[model samples]
Target: MSGQGPMRVLAAMSGGVDSAVAAARLRDAGHDVTGVHLALSAKPATMREGARGCCSVEDSRDARRCADVLDIPFYVWDLAARFREDVVEPFVAEYAAGRTPNPCLRCNEKIKFSAVLERARALGFDAVGTGHYARLSGSATGPTRPVLRRAADPDKDQSYVLGVLRPDQLDGALFPLGDTPKAEVRAEAAARGLVVAEKPDSHDICFIPSGDTRGFLAERIDEAPGEMVDPSGAVVGHHRGVHDFTVGQRHGLGIRRPAPDGRPRYVLGLEPVSRTVRVGPVEDLDVTTLSGADPVWLVDPPSGPLDCVVQVRAHGGTAGATVRVTADGVDVALAEPLRGVAPGQAAVFYRPDGGGDVVLGSATIAATA
Candidate 1:
């Protein structure tokens, strides 16, 4: 491993402090680097609404400026059609089927690692580098094989979204910001004279910049008004669409009557065919066992039970679990119940280690109990 030669790396510049600094670090390490920004919308917005969204004209320009400062070649790749096909449309379809899909995870799986990495290899690059907060074991050049691990910054760990990646994808990938915290990244960007040093991180979903998800969904899905029934099968209220409610939703149940025991009602389940939203006491939301499909194993496919920690959402809670690999998916029995885990959400697995949890595998939750 000593006296390793410099590698060719294609850095993804997202016009943010982290990405700008990531590109700088790669160049500082003497690797041949180039910058690229993804244009995710066909007709990109002229500017971002503060820190609400990204991939806008302003963001592209920012990325280009950073590339110029670093003296690296830069280009914008148009991936709007691919994004719509892979992330957006499937999001709508999943909601229609009464599932809560994670679009960011889908974007990483289909767009960045799949679409961009394929193109990068064709152009004679060694690996596709990003500002993602995740780590890989073994060599940094990516060819020696590496196991994905959690970032040093636990609060910003992005391993959950990246759990879908296969061994081939990991082979030519680089994450320079995995070991650094967010605060230090910003300071580094400012010291490097990057213009986006203080640019606040975009918080909302990219497509829905308005931050009104319900309004956006309502426009795409037709209203199928239905009843909101209690656990005992008694009608308590009504709603316009099953798409309007997700499991574990507490407010806006439209239930005029209160429970006999005076407990707050939460959405327990959705029946798309019946157009029914099941409302019940909060205790019903606690799910202990999860059955999933589309399993992606970063480790060897285990034939028996494996002890691991599982995360149900991007920034939500995680719990200790025992996982059994199934023929097509996984059976995870949680050590403690997690509230409101729904279908179409990823169940990312990690094995507890010394520094941070090492990503083992992931799957799409198909059913929960």
Candidate 2:
């Protein structure tokens, strides 16, 4: 850790205030920084109907302007082909398979860490950086054993989305604004006259700018009307497609009649083979144990069944649990029953220390008991 040369870093600029300030912080820290914007969207015919999300053309221009203000070299890399393949395609496939998938997690895994980082390493950069609101501290042994931590700004902490990062990826990642609050970051950018200083944070899913997943999926995948059944195997309603429903979804169910008990019915499960959506009482949503595949551990694997907190979704409250780790992943039994534990959603594990280091990586929830 003593006197290592200023790290050659590539900052992923999304043309937003957060990323712009992140890049500025890295430059101010004396790191040799370069900015690159991933061109994820293709050009639209009209500006008014443009894709204006995080990866939109307007954001890319903002990134360029921020890079210029920082006096750093910047480039636009076309990742549209790969983004579509890695993020958009699988999104459709998951829905086709009748499982709701987290496209943001896929983007972090396939695009940011996989494709972009690979390109950065190939270009001889020592590390890659992003505007994510997370922190990374070098391991006791140095950068080779990096530890992922949460951002100082809890409201903007992106550790949930980034919990899937691997050790090697962490080794070559930098989050210069991790310890700084978002407001201060914007203040710093404004004081420095950066153009993106006042831009609002992009909240919608980037690729689906219209935020109409149902319409989007219907356009991409063929839809055949499917039966909606009650928990007792009685046909209660019909659905456009099994993919259009989720575990706790209530609206657009098309079930006009109320349940006999006067309590509302919710989507309890999706049967892909039968193409049926099962509706049941809200109590049907409660679950105690969850087991899944393809687990990614941030720290060393747990020696034995260990106690930790499990989060079934982003911003979901942490629940007490005993986690049993196997070669593939971990199985968790919640201390108290939880609702909305859906398949294909991420379950992230955290140590009780409050450091925001994801001791265990997130996984798509495979099952709930």
Candidate 3:
């Protein structure tokens, strides 16, 4: 790799400190780097003031300023239509069907790696660089065959959201912040005179900036009043819609009376067709086994039952499990019972090698036992 000539690279700058430093690192490495900001929303430019989300007009401007400072060519590519079709619409539909969907995973699978990488390849770029906190390991001298691994900074590791990327996508991807700590990244940004060095990290779904997911769903999905019953078939209360609730949700039940055992009630199930929300004790949420669908393997699929660590949610803890890959998906037998395992959430698998946590792949949870 040392003797190889300069490679043409396209850096996707999100107008954040992490991406700014990622682009700068590529340029410093003697790669022919160009920065591109993705315009993901069609909202008015004036709406970006003090916006606490990524991809805003202000974020694009910040990216441009960083590119100008780095002395690299910069351009903004509008992807609003593609984003709505691939990520936003599917999110509403999954919620309507009483499933909790991860829009970030969808964006990684469809927009960033697929749409952005494909476009870059066609434009003669050898690889696309991003600021995600995930590591890649492979030979440095030959053709790159990336093996996805967790970031050195465990708190900021983003491998869960990126587990949906395929092997082919990984070959053309570069994550420069994988080995760098967030604090060091910020320090580097400041040293480079980048303006977004002190910007706060954005939280919650970017589309629902208000953080009112239930209210957002209500606007898109029609209100369907239905019965809220206990596990014993006794009517407890009523709900506006099943889409407004998810498995293990406790608040907003509208039930004034406590359970007969003086215990708190939780949402156990949701029937979209009948619009029924089932409430039960906390013990009902414990699941020993779970199955997922539409598996995406970064490497080769396992031949038989494989022991791995399973992560059910983005910010949730991992569990030791024996995974058996099925024809349609994979079945995970947890070593201990897991609570609040919900459908439509990703189940990312990892193996503990001597190196570190290696990402095997991921699938969407479909059922639990």
Candidate 4:
């Protein structure tokens, strides 16, 4: 907490217990804190009923109430247009291209840390804090730059999603809930008389409020009927659209015929040009080598091959790998074969030391072998 003396901080309050407590904690720590609720939705008030999503008007009101209780200034910033362009549109497009995209990562990369942080700096704030469950070590004043680490609460660790942030962003970033447990955060919110103490966490994409990602995409992209084919290029069934299936998907494929071996078939790949959905055995999903494009390193890129643990998805297990930084990306050779390696998903690299708790950097998966 050194170098945090009375500096102005902008706390992104998401109308949840974690953020409410984060704002309160920053205030108590003597930082000149202001609470900001990002209005990222353009939906009319009538359409926001039941408002369980993060961008709902009800959530904004809740964030304002928390700021009032903490005796801090609160403001709502409209970023709906930017959110649509940066997060929402890309999410729909990536799925349309037959790749699973993490909108939270996109929001963190393009909107939250990039857009909001830049604006906060322009407004004379020293740093921006969030309720994210990730830890940071080192100081801006120190020789060593700050590094992102896993939260103490393993179940709530969010470093994987934050791997896209650069070192410059990490310098002015604050994660108030990083060292605290989720249960303790709720308890503190209750002690502070914050109403969001018992508020359930929003687990789905904010833009897709009803949690129907397929339906949301279906409305945006034109439906193109395609053939569901086996690995040998034989037609098995028909699919409404290529976007309806993802790699490693087994259920909800609408395929009536089971494999000849009387086993379930899993989606192996998607051919958008031919509009073919390829289904194969589950073993075909395993891959030992993965190559990723558009790499973003939190620290300096290594000159030679580096041993690390790579995580392919949010809340997924890590696999040991050797990473070689390439011109366009990084190539990862997994020690053990990993299943369900999907393009367009993040392949976050972590230091193998300290039980793989430190985030080194990340890249978008491009191909697997």
Across 21-84, the per-residue lDDT of candidate 2 in tens digits comes to 8888778888899999998766521221233346766777888998999999999999999999
The number of clashing residue pairs in model 1 is: 0
**Count of clashes in candidate 3:** 0
Clashes of 4: 0
Cα lDDT, all candidates: 0.87, 0.80, 0.87, 0.87
**Which runs in model 3 stand beyond 4 Å of their true positions?**
1-5, 44-51, 139-144
The predicted structure with the larger lDDT, 1 or 3, is: 1
lDDT of 4: 0.87
Q: What is the lDDT of residue 53 in candidate 1?
A: 76
Query: 38-126 in candidate 1: lDDT tens per residue?
Result: 99999888998998878889999999999999999999999999999999899988888889898999998999989999999899987
Backbone clash pairs for candidate 4 read: none
RMSD (Cα, Å) of model 4: 1.6
Which one wins by lDDT: 3 or 4? 4
lDDT of 3 by residue, 1-369 (tens): 123457888999988889999999989989999999998887824333344557877888889999999999999999999999999999999988988899999998899899999999999998888999998865333575568888899889998999988888877788889999999999999999999899877776777766789888989999989999998899989888989988999888889988999999999988889989999999999999999999989767899988888888777658888899998899999988888888999999998555437999889999887
Could you report the Cα RMSD, in angstroms, for every candidate shown? 1.8, 2.4, 2.1, 1.6
Question: Model 1's lDDT to the true fold?
Answer: 0.87
